[model samples]
Target: MGHAADSVTACLSKGLGASVGTIIAGSKSFIAKAKIPRKTLGSGMRQVGVLCAPALVALEENKAKILAEGLNKIKGLKVDTASVQTNIVYSDILKGSNITETHLCKILEAHGVLTMPKGPFKLRLVIHHQISESDVKYTVLHSESCNWVHW
Candidate 1:
């Protein structure tokens, strides 16, 4: 099927959980030409198997739901667990909370957890293969601290 396309690409990060890498395929001539820019952009490297190993584990684990369920238990945060189908989870800050999503992210980061603010009141969390059950618990523990009545 690739013969019909000039080039094909797939990311090995995100859901695949590879630290970082992408697959690019094309005609031999096209690939040869592509190598120059790949190296120029510093994407060409040796021993990349180390970076690609986690994807295999990701295929066997679905940690996002675990994370989403945990987040749903936290106060001031609303998560539709049914919508969590992959490695991404989104939580919204309920109206009663004074804490914005950005503030909540900073609080989590200060406690050794990291998250991204989706909008003024939404938070985005990505559960990669590297995150263990204990890590999820830690995230939830800290997130629960944000359950302050001030929110």
Candidate 2:
């Protein structure tokens, strides 16, 4: 897991650097050619002390628990592990014709199990520390009872 994470991070860093370099080069060329003044560009920085402080603290405190909960959700769903890399998980419903993805979302929402519709027939579940194993079980059971065909 550590090795895979490291590889993903490395790839992301390389990709990010390449993208930033391209953006910077393009912006510089555009600025120089257009003679756009700095003030006109609105590229000013302000001190966001409060926002930065909490964000830093949240990253330090909540990252590990969030990752663990995500793994648990993936395991509970028993679907593609790759889709659980981040906090979001996507699942397809193959239930009855009238019970569309939107209908399923409405059902879950009415039961306080909020989810997002992905496509015409896809639903997205996001795992958070607040959601427990029992919650996952209840969600799955409810979905199954509704005769949702899993994809």
Most accurate candidate by lDDT: 1
lDDT of 2 by residue, 1-151 (tens): 4443312211211211221111112344554653356447864333446434543443343333333333234312324544455445676554344456687798778777788888766677765534555776676666655543432
lDDT tens digits by residue: candidate 1, 49-124: 6755665567458677888898888777789999986688999888878877777888888898889999889999
Q: Candidate 1 clashing pairs?
A: 97-151, 98-151
TM-score of 2: 0.45
lDDT of each: 0.79, 0.49
Estimate the TM-score of every prediction.
0.65, 0.45
Q: What is candidate 1's TM-score against the reference?
A: 0.65
Q: How high is the lDDT of residue 117 in model 1?
A: 94
- CA lDDT, candidate 1, residue 37: 94
Q: Which ten residues in a row have the lowest lDDT in candidate 1?
A: 45-54
Q: Name model 1 segments beyond 4 Å from true.
A: 1-10, 18-56
Cα miss at 26, model 2 (Å)? Answer: 21
* Colliding pairs, model 2: 94-149, 95-149
- Candidate 2: worst 10 consecutive residues by lDDT? 15-24
